[model samples]
Target: ILSDETDPNRLHDLKDTLDRYQVYDSAQIDELVGLYLSGADRDQLDPILDACVAAYNVGLDEDGQVDFKGKAKAFARTYAFVASILP
Candidate 1:
């Protein structure tokens, strides 16, 4: 599923999101999707997620606006529905 990336500029923002602004902000879900577009030797999803989990702005509390588990479940449902419709 690899394709030549036409958006190198956006990929460059990954480090800033993770390092520079993590104390005050969380990386957007769409920003994380950039990992696939990065074409790096190994996907850094696990480490990135772990880092995000540790980030102060991610707010894992029950009333938090950012919900990693909820996002995962939503992705699962969307993927399942799309796959079911595809074939």
Candidate 2:
């Protein structure tokens, strides 16, 4: 995720990937970019992101476990609102 990366450019790259994959809408991507650029600590965002993954995982049976798509969707849905309001 963008939070773990040191380079800001990687966040932009991720936004591109998200848009290209249709994982999130334009508004969600804007929120994500704002969050990353807001100087919030990665430590703060990590657990929230992790929780999104875990919540999504609960819907999956033991045989199937995947993080990328589900996690991204969850993150966008959950975090986007908060990110939009942040300075």
Number of the top-ranking candidate, with TM-score as the measure: 1
The C-alpha stretches of model 1 lying farther than 4 A from their native spots are 1-31, 43-47, 55-58, 62-71
RMSD of every prediction: 11.5, 11.6
TM-score for every candidate vs. truth?
Answer: 0.35, 0.33
How well is each residue in 1-87 modelled by candidate 1, as lDDT tens digits?
A: 013433333334433433443333345455557875786434566666566667644544553434444444444554455466556
Q: After superposition, how far is residue 87 of candidate 1 from its true place, in Å?
A: 9.2
Count clashing residue pairs in model 1: 0
TM-score of 1: 0.35
* Model 2: residue 46 alpha-carbon error in angstroms: 1.1
Q: Could you tell me the lDDT of residue 3 within candidate 2?
A: 46
Q: Give the lDDT of residue 85 in candidate 1.
A: 54
lDDT of 2 by residue, 1-87 (tens): 434524444445545654554333566446556777897688755655565456447744553344346545645644564466457
Off by over 4 Å in 2: 1-33, 62-87
